[model samples]
Target: MSHASEVPASTPTIVVTGAGSGIGRAATRLLLAQGWNVVLAGRTEASLLETAQEHSRALVVTADVSDPEAVQQVFLAAQSHFGSVDVLFNNAGIFGPSVAIDELTPQQWDEVCRINLTGAINAARAAFAHFKVHGGGRIINNGSISAQTPRVNSVAYTVTKHGIAGLTKCLELDGRPYRIRATQLDIGNTASDLLNDFGATQGALQPNGERMVEPTFPLQQAAEAIAYIAGVPLSASVNQLTITAGGMPHIGRG
Candidate 1:
């Protein structure tokens, strides 16, 4: 019988940004469990360590993706540890706040742009460069429901995710010759174990200025979706995927 996970002769190593927590951490775990090597990267060493602890196939790198230098170092460390990089999950992001666009500060906007958009750019560039040499690789950008429709007080996040959608298309076009394929996973609310303990979830503002608790799916489901995308042989590709809670207000706006 053919194995479900037929790891290629060349060891598959994936670099996951924002790997210290939330979706990144969940995806990293699923990837690792599926016989692929993983490089856990984020701003916090302690969290990365916890994610990679006792995992022989895991490499932990403390990287703040917004810093170009730091981002470069992450790929370098991954290449050094695993010999080559096969996939990069462009998944690091933050939700700044829910406020009126006029009330949003310049610093807040810049901060979100730097980490959400610029960070993905740096990582995508690095991965493309590496894939160019290695003949190809995959990059899965973590987009959001906001990418498709704007939510109140989410200017920075919405803008950056729309930027990600653009970036994914660009990569898909430019990387075709080299076998570098790109995909975007536009996810909705995902329940995080870490956040659940703290009761961190709150009402999300609707387009009509209504605040309501957003529906959420298990974080693992998103991780598995990512793994499925990453696992497909290079011959095939999933260009874009949107996985949101069944009742999330994404398909139609209020």
Candidate 2:
């Protein structure tokens, strides 16, 4: 971690969890390019370093968002390196075992809740505390489309995402007086490694028990949307923003 003295005080800083790949990595790269100090926090140190790519404004911190202590450490490291953290991209999550409700084990459910829901809450708690003291900040959560709708054999993932939606609302209500803003970015299919199972040729499982290929947009577009929200001022808050492929069957998803 670089010392706070090394970075200019005026530079805006954002902490991005799960910054190793996919949307998190894309957003981090774009933020760094746009002259923001970024703190890359993820489970894999090597992957976080790769995301940082030796950027002078990037600080790599390895952390599993499920662990509250580790998540707190991420904020501390960010503040120590950049003087203050202005935003937190709460984007760490995982799709648990794809099994029906009856077939899903308790351990599997607990594991998913621990990371997807608990992890997000932990990060938000830390960010809220920091923001309250520093005047204000923004939190952009990667809620995913599952936050509003469910897919077959995705009970664990779906439930946690719904929890994220609730968390976002609570943060918004609670942070109003402190200038802390919260936004939930629900994204649909995007072109990334995580979508390999639901690729154009592979096809994803549909609500009616059939499989169909779903349309997807570029990863860069999703990244740009996040950047736009993060750039919004505290006086104005984007409570919720949903982005999906034009041809994606989300609006009328069964």
Candidate 3:
């Protein structure tokens, strides 16, 4: 319970990372529709532009979240365009190579850690710094149910998402004094480009000589959930939220 009521609204300024695709893109569209001045940051300019084109209210910027310099520029541009950012959708992440840890390459591990974990750290750091000075802001990290339940071939992804849960908790504690609210969404399978990219999802060979991909939830459902979280006032914050596909086997997952 920090001094969140101190600032008057002139339309909330928000920054969303990984805005080029998936949940990020969907969330961006919702925010723009609500008239929030949103800055879209991601590695791909083409995708960013395409996302922005769908909504005239979006400010598109190409940024590699893995780089600190690039993140700084993103912040500067957001502040320059919108004055102050009231919330950060820290959603950039990479679901690393699906393989056993023993078979996973060091390079692959590094890439996942860099994007999913370290990249989150960088974004949170920059956003917190700005928020602290501006009195307070909200942070929402895109976590995965994998953090709680491990997937056999997704070691790196699980590890990074676990780190994200820790990140969210620590930030929630540290940010309380500054009126900065932090939360994480531990999402289960949702319809997105990431799922479509899994080559064997339709049916891939497994140890049992069978391939199985879990059913996916509609992307719109996840998008709506995210928007609801974002729309919550500073007085009340959702510390953590987990929304998954109704029929998904996450409850029984190892």
Candidate 4:
């Protein structure tokens, strides 16, 4: 068979959290371009609408993933718009305060956990339930390389990302009977507002003062990688994937 014919043409209905910006935005655009209907979810309604307006198959829904009720509403809206959710890209997360653990405030700690770890759980809960009823789906989480080797002064973000690894594994096993697949993509510095903000807050400069954070990634590269993982056949699956910048310190424990 030709390579073109080898790829599946199943137009999946995809739900992407944190779709207002960054990797989520890239994923949404890529999926839409590939002829999939994407439901974009994020806290910013205006940005979400802007993303939706650009794509004929986009359905924008604004909701905070940390709030269970809001997450439910978002999913319901997605289902209503797309008939069924074939995949959920659980990308909504916060980097939290880039303070040393000792200096990190209780509020900052809680908020990060709420958005980073709990948000994934809540969205997965909703998505898994829907998949169970609707006959199966895929859940792809946006994990960080820091999940395994953390950066200094980013305890909360690191901890939550580590939790995501466990979550991905657990869900993968549990969803087997339903044919639902769960995977984690351990990302290393891709150019985005998150990295920009992280640099602003944490000083992305080394002691010698080299600038961190490239202006932008070939966003299409990472998005296409994820699109491939999400579009895999039910009989086979990509349980975990990692995509990172070539010069990123993510490969090492740095």
Q: Write the per-residue lDDT of candidate 2 for residues 50-166, one digit (tens) a residue.
A: 888888898888889999999999999887778999999999988887778999999999999998999999999999999999999999988989899887778999999999999
Clashes of 4: 0
Residue 98 lDDT in candidate 3: 76
CA-lDDT, candidates in order: 0.83, 0.89, 0.82, 0.81
Order the candidate numbers by lDDT, best to worst. 2, 1, 3, 4
Q: TM-score for model 1?
A: 0.91
Ranking of models by TM-score? 2, 1, 3, 4
Residue pairs with clashing backbones, model 1: none
In model 4, the runs with Cα more than 4 Å from the true position are: 1-10, 200-216
Decide which is better by lDDT, 1 or 3.
Answer: 1
Relative to the true structure, candidate 2 reaches a TM of: 0.96
Q: Give the Cα-based TM-score of candidate 3 against the true structure.
A: 0.91
lDDT of 4 by residue, 47-100 (tens): 887666656677777788999998898778766666778999999988877667
lDDT of 3 by residue, 9-112 (tens): 37787889998889998888888787787789998888887777745457777888889888888888877766789889999988878788999999999999
Clash pairs (backbone) in predicted model 2: none
> Among all windows of ten consecutive residues in candidate 3, which has the lowest summed lDDT?
1-10
Name the lDDT value of residue 130 in candidate 1. Answer: 95
lDDT comparing candidate 1 with the true structure: 0.83
